[model samples]
Target: MSTLRTLFLSPRVTATGHALADAARRRGARVETLREWRVPEQQRRAEGSSLYAGPLFADAVARELGLGLLEAPQDWLARLPRELTLRDVEFGTIAEAWRLRRPAFVKPPNDKSFPARVYPDGSGLPGPDAVDGTEPVLVSDIVTFAVEFRLFLLNGEVRTASRYATRGALDVAPLERDPRRAEVLAFAERLAGTGLPSAVVVDVGLVDDAGWAVVEANAAWASGHYACDADAALDVVLHAARPEGEFGAADRRFLRPAPEVVRD
Candidate 1:
């Protein structure tokens, strides 16, 4: 049974967000686009509500509604074995990354706190004046991906996937048309039930010279569907953001910390 009765969206809507909202409506669920950060009084009294928005907006609304948003641990990618990652990756502070003398790919683990890109050297990174040196970041050896696909995983299986990029450019296409479809599915199967939240997004790609490698994990509630089946993506989003009381023991460990709520 679906646990979603109402789907709340952030003030800013994207194409993917509209698709999800339409899908939710087709499934007999009411959808509402939030006018502001504050949850409306009617929604506050509604039952079985779930949210799909950016990390910051999702966190605030989820806190107000007592919902739990599931996401991979900040260092989940960094902890994966070399066989899966296919390159060296480390989780450390910006201050630590600033000491890198060689080129590397650096990004924040869960949010867009900083621009995620390759830096020629430490000097290319944001200085202490623009960002706090203590912020966490993922530093990885630079590599090129020929193509990248986004997999929306639910219950340890890939429910839907879409080719989201080609050679670092936005190129959305159905996964079924790709000749590498079988290979991508097979590689993703290896990561089934591998400690990620039951519903999450995982990006995998074919490196220029390497085989398949994981790009990163993202919270399903905040992920873009691209060409993925909107209905299937909606299913993942429902599971990714649900009432806190319904969380299972396994899912609890992957829950994102609740945001602090201030009341007048």
Candidate 2:
């Protein structure tokens, strides 16, 4: 039986959220769409509760309810072998990225703190006045993928997957229909021991002439389902966000840092 008794959703429920909510209902779990940052008084004491939302909002709710949300380490991608990433990637601060003399793909590792795109050069990045100089970001060589897939992983195995794009455009399709499905799964299995949270999203793509390479890793709580099976994706979400008391020893290392609450 699933331990999830109630699932909290963002106030503005997205198509993905709706799908997960529906799946939760089938599992006999209550769903609540929060209208604000505050947790409802009644749910404050609810047990077996979890959340699915964006990073900032999810962080706030997790802190309020003492839930442990798991995510990849901020430097996970940058630390991966170049053989896996298929490009040179570095973990550095926004200020450091500003010193780049050549075009590079830059993005925040765990949050949407800044736009993730290929900047012409250092001058094209956001100014220090706009973003903190010390904020962590990933800078990598530019690579184009001909096809991209999202895999929902749980317990070091891919529970579900979907082809989310082709040639940088939206093109959702079931992984079962793809001819290269086995290759994709094989690549994901190779990443199983890479220290990611048990439940997380891994995107892999076929670089134009580079074969398959990892695009990035995302928190299951914040990733889109695309064409994935909602039930399987929900399993990942439940594992990703659980009561702090339910976390195993290994899970502790992957917990996302609690966001500091701002008092009015």
Candidate 3:
């Protein structure tokens, strides 16, 4: 009976955002889609120099979409707002960071962060200049994890959870251990203690064969859509909408609103 305005961000249509958009349409709510980065006309003209252009375009996209920006704080480079959450590992100094144990992880602290290439805890990945050596960088003890889990959060509540055995980019397998399963779910719950955005994914992994650790929180927009259950994932996402059939067609959907007209 009420109308709401929602904005979803993703480089491309993703499962989480798609479901949310579907729900919103069914509920008669308006939804808009935006990307993390949008290259400008002039910049794109250069052709071969778009590698470092993500941030520049992403900033523009944030303005166009009228939504708060997200970033991972692991590197001093992310340049996030102070009030935004900072990762524990994104410490300012390597001297200070030495306090952390080896075999932990060093990753970006925010959602928009491109995943940092992980380095072993004490393997001298950084070399002599590692800490005092270079500009501000994100570093953490490599997590000697026993298990990893990905949990979905819809409007601040847990929707569904899945366990993983990851060895690299594509080797993700469903977890087979009860303790690993139990730990991942539990970690997801703990992260909810901190306030998070409306639609997001809470990824948790283990550290040092001991306690469960926070991997990195991600926006449903940019992250993978469905790894565990597609329909269930959609249900949680579409909960905010009206009914399912209001949109023109379920398969080809458009949530991006028409541009406003000028009064002049």
Candidate 4:
């Protein structure tokens, strides 16, 4: 049997990473850890069933390790309900964003290059001194939601889901059957039919007055599981960024490794 290899960034290994490592082991996968960003040149190339890394290192690892990190297409936004999506514009400079005539929410689409917040207008945003005005900034119309949920999807199937927040507060609730479940599922199903990535995280929220709407789409590899099932979430994670038909014998490094030796 071939080995199912999974690599993670050792430096940024969080509780979520640990949980995934454990779950992968249970599924007969071999898990490997590395400092993805600064991998020694000699060790740059590796073979594995799957790989997960921070956005900064993900591309590099995927290239060198021969893994595929699934992702939504660039124009996926066009496939969503235009009414639910906030009007967004990409600016190369805060000064360029400052030219907006109306209020909106602003953020970097994929990174923390700039703060994501509501601004009265372009001029109301932080100046160039706060962040790199030359970096790309996404300015979008402001929208609000009463309840927000995160769904882990795999090949059009909603494998696991959880209520992540309510009224902007950190509220972890299970996404069980309810009055809005059917409607929510319908929306997700619509998105699945789109050209969006087969495996990804879809954040949906209820605006009450506006009904259900899409909050955003996120790459499953870098998203948090929230209160979703770890085992089920792991299933999504495995396929979220894996090569085709690469399964093999289980690597037991994480299953039953040597005990850590601590010095007093």
- What is candidate 4's lDDT per residue for 93-162, written digit by digit as tens? 5668878788877765544455678877888776767865665566655667888889998878899888
Worst 10 residues of 1 by lDDT: 38-47
* RMSD (CA, Å), each prediction: 1.5, 1.2, 11.6, 8.5
> For residues 1-264, what per-residue lDDT tens digits would candidate 2 score against the true structure?
237789899886788999999999998999988899878677784788988999888877787776889899999998898889999999999899999999999999998877899999988888978987999999999999999999999998899999999999999988998998999998987896787988899999999877789999999999999999999999999999888778888888999999787856
Q: Which of the two, 2 or 3, has more lDDT?
A: 2
**C-alpha TM-score for every candidate:** 0.95, 0.97, 0.49, 0.76
lDDT of candidate 3 at residue 90, scale 0 to 100: 52
For candidate 4, give the lDDT. 0.64
* Candidate 3 lDDT, 1-264, residue by residue in tens: 113344333455445556546655565545554333453343232211101112333344433333232222234222322222223455454444345445545543432333365544534334455334333346643444455566667755667666654543333434333446655555555554354544456666665535556666654334454344544454433332222232233211312222332332
The regions of model 1 sitting more than 4 angstroms off are 262-264
Local distance difference test values of all predictions, in order: 0.89, 0.89, 0.43, 0.64
Mark the regions of model 2 whose C-alpha exceeds 4 Å error after superposition: none
Give the alpha carbon lDDT tens digit for every residue of 1-264 in model 1: 245799989999699899999999998988989888888766773678888999888767887776889999999899998988899999999999899999999999998877899989888888999987998899999889999999999987899999999999999997988899999999998896567989899999999877999999999999999999999999999999988878899899999998686767
Q: List the residue pairs that clash in candidate 2.
A: none
Model 4 lDDT at residue 27: 71
**Candidate 3: segments with Cα more than 4 A from true spot:** 1-58, 69-90, 93-105, 111-115, 119-137, 167-182, 230-264
